[model samples]
Target: MTKRSPFLELDGVTVDFPIYSGGSRSLKKTLVSIGTGGRIKRGGGRISIQALKDVSIRLGHGDRLGLVGHNGAGKTTLLRTMSGVYEPTIGRVRASGRMATIFDFTLGLDFDATGYENITLQGMLLGLTRSGVAGLVDEIAAFTDLGGYLDMPIRTYSAGMLTRLAFAVATSTDPELLLMDEWIETGDADFFQRAEARLKTLIERAGILVLASHNLALIRHYCTSAAWLEHGQLKAIGPVEEVLAAAGLSVANAALAGRQSFSNAQ
Candidate 1:
């Protein structure tokens, strides 16, 4: 059978998060019309925040999309929604093919488990069968360079070691649709170089990629198109350069502008 091409679509999606005040009289005054990203709605004695409002996007095989926005702009929320972590309250998400998400490297890790055991655990959580995980064990182990430490419980591992282990396992499988929140950085220079190379290979192999990041240069390098989101609404979507220009970001000033936007949002 010929393999089907990967695709992802969100139609008229709107995500709302209900806020429970627990009958606290002060809660209503404190949260109403406050904060960024979403609008607060109060009706029928209920309060809710609309994280995404009427958002629609469709991506097919070979489409590399970059999401750009300031903090609380719903970029991460959108990525999570695309990964099926959050179902739209008022719309639909349709996707085809095996999907992989890099939102949290240590998502399924257990600190008390030995490195080798955690490998099996995390692999299974990533949708791999037990036998399939067994096949990739040696490769993932070697990539981490943990050696005999693989026999030790992960709680004893340093932060860098944990990062190496999680990253190695997360990238073990080839995915047709990949979603990432941002570029991952490792501690040591040597490991960072190796991880970057491996990450490039993984991105190249994916049929579709949706990456949410504040780094314009990184997005320009990896994505063919871009979407600018503001306050949970998509402001613009088109070619990377055009969208970046529309957002008043240029390669020369993107880094500084990104920093300013982040700070201002906070």
Candidate 2:
């Protein structure tokens, strides 16, 4: 009995974002100048930044991939590309699983809406129907443990409360492909305990997890494989230890400190 191949594939994938001068950032100006298809040009004074360049990756079931790199290293861009938020400028990206991205917990949340209402709104943003989210209201509410605060507007909620509600709603459904920017480590000690448990459960249930984190120890402990991105390119992809070593990290020390393995790059 042999195993199946990966459901996700990226080949020569390139994503570009045009750099508009401050004056040309207005909607009217942007609309009139929507011509460049992700390439550099001189006459237009519009330059495109290649956030990802000829990058390739393959992810299979049970693959926990750790994305390692610096702040502008295209890790998040690659994750967004995989999540279908950004279309490739030069190549192709294909996947065959239900994907959920937790890039920013507060991204689609409504500050003026009550916690309960925002849950429905966020759920809808995840491609669920209003009725679909309504059905899970109790479960999500229970997970947040906000009690009466659920009726209050999100603007009234504290940072920890916001995080709790956001996390609960984000993980309400089980997604086959889970893409996370980093480990959730905010909130108080008690909340932290609960969040840790919930995160562990969610990760276990996910068939594939792509975690982009600066914490190398988490990567070494959780991910069987790693992908290192540097300046909008795939630097290395292989076993965790090997990739860390290639990035000039003292793997043993990094594992103990829970710090980033790419100290040189940082």
Candidate 3:
């Protein structure tokens, strides 16, 4: 029997963002640095940030991978790289199957457009055809329950209303590979339960799920494997418990230690 190909593969993938340290504001200066592989030197009046450095991972079908790290540890950067929003400055990323990402739910929405119109706009931005988006409008509108507000310009909606509209449109479609920065929880208690159920269903339906989150319990519950990142490098990758333990976040071990301490005191 032959082995299956990876649904997602990253080998030595690095991402760089230019830092203009009081240098020329000209496009030419920035363009010149794009191909330099994020190199920085003293007195250059320019700097480059290696947001991800030589990060590698592989995920086949049915894999739920969690990413754990401190802030500015390249967790979000890696997710953006996987979603094709950020191209790797060096090395490569190969992803098979259709990919859908739920990061920044309000991104790409037109404030001037009506809620219904923005549904078509956001859906198209997600790689759906016009007809494809049209088909989803009713489903999204029903899920959002915006009713008359759906015909009003998005700018007129309150912040919570806008969030509802965005979440509805985002989760309306399914994809082969799903990427999320963090678990999305919204609304009051009544609505949060509904959102939680929808989120659970979405995760269950995806072929592959890569989630970057700070919630250790949530990660352990949903992810089959995990990776720890620090300073733009992968510190560890393996079973969820092993990776979490290596990252000094052993929840189970800590609980056990707490019990032992209490017993000794008794």
Candidate 4:
């Protein structure tokens, strides 16, 4: 059998979320009249918000694609669509590979459970078997450095500690297709430094990566290509530099501005 190449393709995909407004008919009518940020459609007396509209993209092995746009510009929605979290209202999404998503680190976490227990839970949620998660226990624990805290209920842990625990478990999976909502930056400075290195390694190992971030310099540094989304539509896409230019963003300027902000904070 021939080896299959990893690829992801979205064909005229549009995602609509139905809005259930339980109120008097007058209230529903008012909402429809006022409209919302997303495109609103009314049918069968139900209102729906179109989060993605006629968007199409194709990515193959070695593709590092960055998604750029303002908040609520369908960046996260597109990532979810690619991850099969959201079925398109129309059109198709076809992907071939082992996929992992880092959208929400705490997605499958249980605050009432111990760190070790949550590790098993989250790992299983990520498609690992019981034995598989057991095998990763030591490595995940070492990466988190939670130590005795792993035996204690996670609710007793601090926010940063929870982030450390969740992030460690989340990144344990080796994926051919990796989808991330934003660059994973959590925990204390020291942990962040280590996490950054680990994240870079993961990105390098992935056959295809789709990252949605507001940091233009980070995108330029990691991505070969870029896609610009606006109002739930693909506005532009091409080489990183070209797409950034089209989006009115300059990587150099963004980096300089970041430095200035840091210096001012100091």
Q: Which candidate, 2 or 4, has the higher TM-score? A: 4
TM-score of model 3 vs. true structure? 0.84
**In model 2, what are the clashing residue pairs, if there are any?**
none
Clashes of each: 0, 0, 0, 0
Candidate 1 scores a C-alpha RMSD against the true structure in Å of 6.0
Model 2 scores a C-alpha lDDT of 0.84
Q: What RMSD, rounded to one decimal, does every model reach? A: 6.0, 5.1, 7.5, 5.6
Give the lowest summed-lDDT range of ten residues in model 4. Answer: 257-266
Give the higher-TM-score candidate: 1 or 2: 1
Please report, as a residue range, the 10-residue window in candidate 3 with the lowest summed lDDT: 257-266
List TM-scores for all candidates, in order. 0.88, 0.85, 0.84, 0.86
What TM-score should be assigned to candidate 2? Answer: 0.85
- Estimate, for each residue in 1-266, the C-alpha lDDT of model 1 and write its tens digit: 78899999999899887787754346554475354424444474567788888899999999999998877889988998998889999899999998999988898788888999999999999999999999999999999999999999999999999999999999999999999988786789999999999999999999999998887878999999999988889889999999988877777778685675455423
Q: List the residue pairs that clash in candidate 3.
A: none
lDDT of 3: 0.84
* Candidate 2 segments whose C-alpha is farther than 4 A from its true place: 1-6, 22-45, 251-266
All candidates in order of TM-score, best leading = 1, 4, 2, 3
How many residue pairs clash in model 3? 0
Q: In order, what lDDT does every prediction score?
A: 0.88, 0.84, 0.84, 0.88
lDDT by residue for model 2 (1-266), tens? 46444377899999989887664678765555565444344765667898999999988899999998777899889999998889998899998777888888777888999999999999998889999999999988998889999999999999889999998888888888889987876568987888888887888888898998878877887888999899899999999989877876565655633544344223
